[model samples]
Target: MTQSPSPTLPGSRAQTLASAESLVSAYEKAGYTRAHPGILQLAEPFLDLSGEDIRARMFLTSGRSGEELCLRPDFTIPVSRDYLTSEVAGRPHGYCYLGPVFRDRGALPGEFLQAGIESFGRSDKAAADAETLALGLEATAHFGMDTPDIRMGDVGLFVAMVRALDLAPAWKQRLIKDFSRKASLAQDLDRLSLATANGRPDYQGVLAALTGSDPKAAHALITDLLSIAGISAVGGRSIGEIADRFLEQSALDASATLPPYTRSLIERFFSISSDPLEASATMRSLAHDAGIVLTPTLDLFDARNAEIARRGIDLKRITFSSSFGRGMDYYTGFVFELRDGTGEEPLVAGGRYDDLLTRLGAPEPIPAVGFSVWIERLAGGAS
Candidate 1:
């Protein structure tokens, strides 16, 4: 059976009800049908779909039949699954979900209410992105918070810049993977700038300890060695995957590094932190200085910003940062977080996940964006 939101979920019953009503009604007015995904959901999908951060925090369990399961950590993944299973998934549709999402948040409650809308199949993606973000802001305003800090980012734009730099695909993948962590991202860039001549000890062993033209034989030999050494794959990763990772890392050359100019350009790109309009200009300037074409990404950012302004969300209060994406890998573009002046955690946060549906079983890619408001955080600020 699925876990449902209770009156005692968070805050006062009345306050929770009011916030739920406000969010659901707001999204419904924008043509989103209500969607409720089961709380006890399959675990494998999340294990495969979510980024490392969320994957680490999931509450995992197993059923009587030995099937892995997890308490729902967020509504987006579940609702997307619901939509994909529906007849109308091929067409554009909007969905609103308000319920308890479980997670191990350390000091915070494990069970809390999250309310949000998901827009799918919209042909005008930039408008859809703006509309969802604006809706989150409007819902927050409905709860009486005004002038919240709105931090925006575009993961796609950063990836685009990397692509323009003519970096290797391996390098591009590293940047995207570390985009959500600023300190780690800087370390990643710094590592790229450092040259390494030959393999390290571990790499040397993986390359030299077992040698064969056939990968299957090499994999068997590695697994046998691991078994003898009593080393096992942890955190749901399989032995085969571990072996593959070992091989990939072993094959990498440590001495190869990026050029000084390219590293400087990367730093400049990430240094952009300003109001939405001006940050867009700064990105353009950086691209020009590097002689890398970034107009397409910047144009989309402009269109989305225009849409946000058209909704009267006050672009002045909205800042855009180049390295501000959340830890969720599915966020392909336009990530934002809304918070009161003094709150440690965001009251509302979300972004566009354009490739997510395809990654999560849709026949083709769909344009999607949405945000969720934390009931406790929102109500706590009000109190």
Candidate 2:
């Protein structure tokens, strides 16, 4: 069988390369150093660091040398790995790169240059989140957009609320992963509840068994659950793999359940204004009255609002919503998407992924966040 090429991809690779260079120049001017050792990278590190959705979205290949490789879809993972493995550790570093990332399409195969930065080894989360947002704004402005709208959300609060509810870790993970996708989350919750009631060890039961302080017991229980669930270690994580993680990690406080309207309200928040300051106030009030003790997330929200205000961004020109979660599995806090005024798809998107670097084997957790503007979309809309 013969397959035809996709027409949506650029006819000339040079155009993509040129666009990528422009983005690279913009990021570099904003203090992101260039770090292009090699355009190609070992795919697994990126897949491991990127959220599940990103991994799924990539176009992978196997080298003739028998190593698995991929055309990099996002730059942060490779940038992080390069920095961590290099002499750049123990000190803060920022690097930007521009390169083509490949993705297969049945009818619209495409490749585009991705330009972004990874701020490594810094734990000032507010600073990191702010810098990422600032860079995105700067990059957009450099691209000549007069007033690129920015929308934001906080996944840390979302996770905190989930943990505070005292849901089992497995249930929490499943719910967290699906929070942005309402129908799937609802269905999974129903399915897990059914499994728990039927005496089969669903994800929640697996989590409950491993929630105690005993590491040995947790490992044994996880092993048994894996065997029972018929899941195996693929790429070093079984269905039970994250269960063991639950045991090793300190449990979150459960003194209060987050407001019932939290999730639904988040949806509404996204539906509202892009005015950063106004959004912060709305979120604060919601968290306060809901008794969610939003203290942990409020600072970042305030900082962002203050930044927007400081920049003299028109509150009326932006729409802010407390509930605009972009449904990635790894976002920890300060999530957002820059949408066209019509609000269909995010032209630029990212947020706090503090825990992701650690999950991918950084010695200490690196509080990190960066946004990728869909260059093609941005350029297309402008044209």
Which candidate wins on lDDT?
1
Off by over 4 Å in 2: 1-20, 63-67, 188-274, 342-344, 381-383
TM-score each candidate: 0.89, 0.72
Summarize candidate 1's per-residue lDDT along 1-383 as a digit string, tens digits: 22344666565766666767766877787799989788899998888878777788899999999999999998889999899999888689999878888888788677877888888898897788888887888867877886788888899898788888766565677777778877878877776665432224445544544433377877787778777788787566677788877655444332235788888888788788989899988888888888999998889999988988888777888878887888787888899999887876888999998999998888788888888888767877332
lDDT (Cα, tens digit) per residue for candidate 2, span 2-47: 1122456566544544655777777778677887745567887766
Cα displacement (angstroms), candidate 1, residue 293, comes to 1.9
Tell me the lDDT of candidate 2. 0.63
Worst 10 residues of 1 by lDDT: 247-256
Candidate 1 regions with alpha-carbon error over 4 angstroms: 1-11, 196-231, 234-237, 251-255, 381-383
Q: Which candidate is the best by TM-score?
A: 1
